[model samples]
Target: MSLHSVFERLAARPWLAAFVFGAASALALPPVYALPVLLLTIPGLLTLLGRAKGWRQAAWIGAWFGFGHQLVGLYWVTHAILTDVAKWFWLVPLAAPGLALPMGLYSILPALVAWRLAPGWPRVLGFAGAWVLAELLRGWAFTGFPWNLMGTAWAFAPLPMQPAALIGAFGLSFFTILLAGLPLLGARRAFGTGGAILAVWMGYGAWRLQGLPPQGTGAQLVLVQGNVRQDLKWDPSHRAAIFQRYVALTSQGAAAAVAEHPEAPVLVVWPETASPFLLAQDPEAIRIATEALPPRGLLLAGTVRAEWGPDGRANALANSLVVLDADGQRHGLYDKSYLVPFGEFMPFGGLLPIRLAAGGMDFSAGPGPSTLPLPGGLPAPGPLICYEVIFPGEVVGAERPGWLLNVTNDAWFGNSAGPYQHLASARMRAVEEGLPMVRAAQTGISAVFDRAGREVARLGLGETGVLRAELPAAGPPTLFGRWGRWIPGGILILSLAVALLLGWRRPSQV
Candidate 1:
């Protein structure tokens, strides 16, 4: 049989081809960035949708594809559950698929909409638009989990990433899907249009990066990577050793950073929950954490903050980033508002039988995003703890901060693509806001990116090291920065509108 016959045969199977093609599409995303593969997978998915018997079958095909896509992208989640396998052993296999099941539901709307459109341009546009709409919905629905967005596929480097400065990541997703599906009907003009648009897209990005490299902000950063294992991070017996490891690394990192840039103000950053003890509740923990700070230097350490009740018990807990000075005086505190579902708090708490988070109590969330001033004349930064950096257009607040700080614990998914994907999201945010982003991840992939999404320095996964780099000066506000989600939302709306109009004018026979 020819290639067409084989593909048709595979598409005939309700579950096989759609799921395989969907899983294949994830290869276009970060760490694996096989972008050209989208030409085959997306067109193949449209073909599968075209072969569906009806709207319900189309939805099911889309859902199966989504399930495969998300299953591969989220397979690393199983590593987290395996950390305490004794309690979650049975859940190890279910973790990725469990999350993929619900995420798969988001693809249904796009499939249904595409089912209504003509097989040529209308189906392509409608599918891409409705797909982004579903992505947007999942981004905010149920407190949002916007991972592996189609736009992030361009995050392999700084050049292709510049468009994010204009239209943001979601906007990039719109065009990415639109272009990738242009040849679904084997139209000659569609092939040429796709090529020309891609050329323009890349050429524009190149032009945007042509200027001089960004200048330094006269501030230096020391990102401390403890390389702590997830299982040992919270152990009572290993608590003292873990705290000591961070203290030692901090002192060494601070000393070296000050020596490199003596005049510049040094800022030491510890990854999320690096301190084994509760720094907010323990005075001695604060003292030890600040001991390594250079004169006029500051520290941003992630730790659990507690609200102690009068009954000698904690009423609430917050995953927080606490800033401190060398004198053991606290400077500022930013509590994490975007808590991870199940990892930090169980969704519909009482309805669930078991708790996925470490403790019995779910973490209390902080007020939404805020920009805070820093001490020592350093630039003020917006803090995004853990997975909060994954959410595009939601990283900043009313007042744009000078820089972005992300503290996370990627050790939960050791040696996996999860940490690298997380780093890519941080890079996209830097480009979108035209601001530098400093990310400190426990165990690996701690990196610094300039305003234009250029990588400045990095420490690979499972490494114990401190990266010292001067903070790059923030660039001018970007189009996306000024308008936020409006640009992408507008693109999504216009694409869908045109698709619907075309479908009305020329009805499709599926």
Candidate 2:
């Protein structure tokens, strides 16, 4: 068939096109296709939005595409549902789809924006601006989900992607869409337009890579994945076993580090909730843990913390990370600021039946980002527990850190792509902040990524192992790290302004 005939046939069923696009987008994630999936989605989304019959039609197309995108990309929701079979039927309809449905709304924003600004402005530019605007909203609206943005697919690629340091991931998303949308313009015989879009993207990426220097070097670190089962992670009966596993893992990591670099201090990292029993409450456990660490090393591990209110109302349970020095003394504690909905804490407290679930909790959110002071007054390290890593611009604050330490327990999602996807998100933050990241996850994908988002070393998902590597030193402060979301927010505002000005000049043209 002719190219024109194929385009006509594909245009006939926008919903089908959307489903394929959504599924293809999910395939961009790890353990399947790598970064190339990003190149596909850009053209796919642009074609769907560009071919829409009207604004209403565009909305429908965007919504279904968003739905399909979320439905497939977030299939890990089924793992949480499987935890409680009693609520399986109800939860699948209520919680599972509800999660994807709201997230899917983000896709509609791009469709609307693209449809409104289409067929006039360069399709590549218009699509890029609209897609970035939608992604920005996805990160901001309703506390945001910035998980798996198109830019994240490049997490494993060799490219430094430090451009995210200047414009943040949302900006990178815009560039990706622009490159992808160029093909759509090419399909319409707009060769010069397509070539220009591709050139600009490659040129900007190349320039950014050259500008950002490598951050750190040769500091030995160990990431311990304890392999704790989700069902037993919080159970009282398994506390001792959990402690033993982490201790064993830490010991193994320390041994590996010693063999590789005898002179360097071993910085052993344990995943979130590596200790089922509260370290603050259990002195014996703390004593046992301290003794397990090397005399001249640092052990950072996650634990639950409880503080009683003056009036004694249930107090507050905090998900937190504690830093232990070589002397086994607690140096500092970093509480998790961004808690996971339902998993870490129940939203609205008693308003929903979610409390009846087995794994739900009432943990309190921690205070905003703060630095954890290292011995000898080196630049403090930024700490994020679990879901906190998903938020792009917020991870590092006004003060940049030597590196980012993310502690997560991915056991909840089992042996699925969830862990890999989570690791990808964590890697993106390293790129976004221009800071190397040390990630410790329970039951899988424990690894270290450089500021460029390249995986320096990693233990595969579902593997029971310890990752021992040396973290690179801190690079110059990233623009996103220093300024947070301001840069991306400005881009969105400017794009909107340009779209509005053009619309005003030619009111009936779109």
Overall lDDT per candidate, in order of appearance: 0.88, 0.73
Give the 10-residue window scoring lowest on summed lDDT in candidate 1: 501-510
User: Mind giving the per-residue lDDT tens digits that candidate 2 earns over 184-270?
Assistant: 545664467656755765676677666655555555788888787776666788878878888887887787787778877778888
The candidate maximizing lDDT is 1
* Highest TM-score scorer: 1
Q: How many backbone clashes does candidate 2 have?
A: 5
Worst 10 residues of 2 by lDDT: 501-510
Q: Residue-wise lDDT of candidate 1 within 111-157, one digit each (tens)?
A: 87887777888889988888889989989999999999999999999
lDDT of 2 at 415: 76
Misplaced by over 4 Å in model 2 are 1-10, 29-53, 86-89, 93-95, 120-123, 187-218, 309-314, 355-361, 377-379, 499-510
- Cα deviation of 478, candidate 1, in Å: 0.9
